[model samples]
Target: MHKYYLTHLQELESEAIYIIREVVAQFDRPAILFSGGKDSIVVTHLAKKAFWPAKIPMPLIHIDTGHNFPETMEFRDKLVENLGVQLIVGSVQESIDKGRAVEESGINASRNELQIVTLLDSIESHKIDAAIGGARRDEEKARAKERFFSHRDEFGQWDPKNQRPELWNIFNGRKRMGEHFRVFPISNWTEMDIWNYILQENIAIPSLYFAHQRDAVYRDNTWLPASEFLQLREGETIENKLMRFRTLGDITITGGIESDADTLEKIVAEVSATRSTERGNRSDDKRSDTSMEDRKKQGYF
Candidate 1:
């Protein structure tokens, strides 16, 4: 399909493949941060295509929040086993047990933020010079300003203002010791683009994305599941909602919307017609408008 005639999604796939090849040609030790999320799954798909006859050269790095859905873990295990790729798990629970981070003290408490410590530790422990992620620009305002080869200091802190100019696809990954680079291949893709690409390539995603009925409680303009962390307040009420998750994170933070878009075509149509951003359902960003930027500066991926 790589010919004179270029389709939009084909172009995006070609670009992503090019970036993956670039990373393989450039870095000595690189790893893909896989969260079993849709974006990361797409990234993993591209990695497989990047080296078709040969195995994927990079390892899959998972930052486990310890509050992840069981389905995601099962998918992670299967994908790693099938792909024959090395899986490096970074556990937030270990960080908490080591007193590096403390568990929150409320009903709605979560271990999402504590993942940063584990992620950084994994990087250093594995001696990974570069970490590739599936972050897209259109996902968030702060993420929109990210560079393709974003640099992190010894402490894994991201400096927004100080970044190398990515002119004409010239990526500067040069760095001193104790520093590493983050490579986001699909930086230009939108949510719609992602769906269209998936539809075009016929890539398989986890089953949780489709429609399902779950016992949920309404709170703070989001339908949170009846997980152990979620508590029914004095006035809050529980309901049976036909819901599906738009974004996956800590069980306490991720939100679901009433949906019946079970098929891929229906999902694409629904997402295209939607008005809100994907992170709208995520309670972590609700802390403040600048919360994401603040967290990124503090080395929270």
Candidate 2:
């Protein structure tokens, strides 16, 4: 008899694929929430693999914050073009213009929280019964409490106390007419596992994750890219530095860390030796201890 074992990366891949397939089986209309981040890129890759030979059955939903890295938008457009999948964009700017959401004021202002309204609007408009996201448990405390299949109420609110149990790897996606589910296929993957899988699979990600020269300003202990949307404080000055993003979000809130790990192998090695959580530099989470949880409850993906 011969015994064989799947590598940890392979195991994670298998689980993610199984969860994705389950989403297809359980939901009427499902879409992947792609933000051009490495995690979402990985989820899109797995979705490709999950239904290989046949085109991805569902479309991709992007809640465009309008405050994004140019590199991320370029990569997102190219990836969507290559995949031959439908792309539905929910514009936050449009939401603000219509008075659906109000933009924040002051130096630390970000469109992060405003995304909740736009996302919920998009879901209702698109009639998306299940929205598959790339959020993982290891990234934040709020995400840590998420189930593989998280249910939402008629108004798209998440109730952590009323979650369904998934013992024995079985998921129950049963919901009422007005309710929906947020499915996280890569819920079990960590930052390290993501980088390792990207390296192993030679996946293509945005250049923002690689070390490059950018004009940035030091704010709240993180290097924030000095974009046109950023309002400079009285004493703050932008300086060019070799920086890279561990995670990608809105341009204002997604901070970069100074590093020389441009290649995938180097990123893997760097992540392995790091002591901080990947979301440590994300200013959105730093607002309060329950920031992410509060946002999640209001249907922010």
lDDT of 1 at 172: 84
- Candidate 2 residue spans exceeding 4 A from truth: none
Alpha-carbon TM-score of each model against the true structure: 0.96, 0.98
Estimate every model's Cα lDDT from 0 to 1.
0.88, 0.92
Q: Pick by lDDT: which candidate is best?
A: 2
Worst 10 residues of 2 by lDDT: 1-10
Task: Provide the lDDT at 137 for model 2.
Answer: 94
lDDT of 2 by residue, 1-301 (tens): 2558888899899999999999999999999999999999999999999999988899999999999888989999999999999999999999999999999988678899998999999999999999999999998988999999999999999998878888877999999997999999999999999999999999999999999999999988889999899888889999999999999999989999999998988898888999888788998999899989998898876
- Where does candidate 1 clash, by residue pair? none
> For residues 44-100, what per-residue lDDT tens digits would candidate 1 score against the true structure?
999999999899999999998888888889999999999999999998999999988
Q: In candidate 2, how many Å is residue 295 off? A: 0.9
Model 2, residue 216: what's the lDDT?
A: 98
Specify the highest-TM-score model's number.
Answer: 2
- When summed lDDT is taken over every stretch of 10 residues in candidate 1, the lowest stretch is 104-113
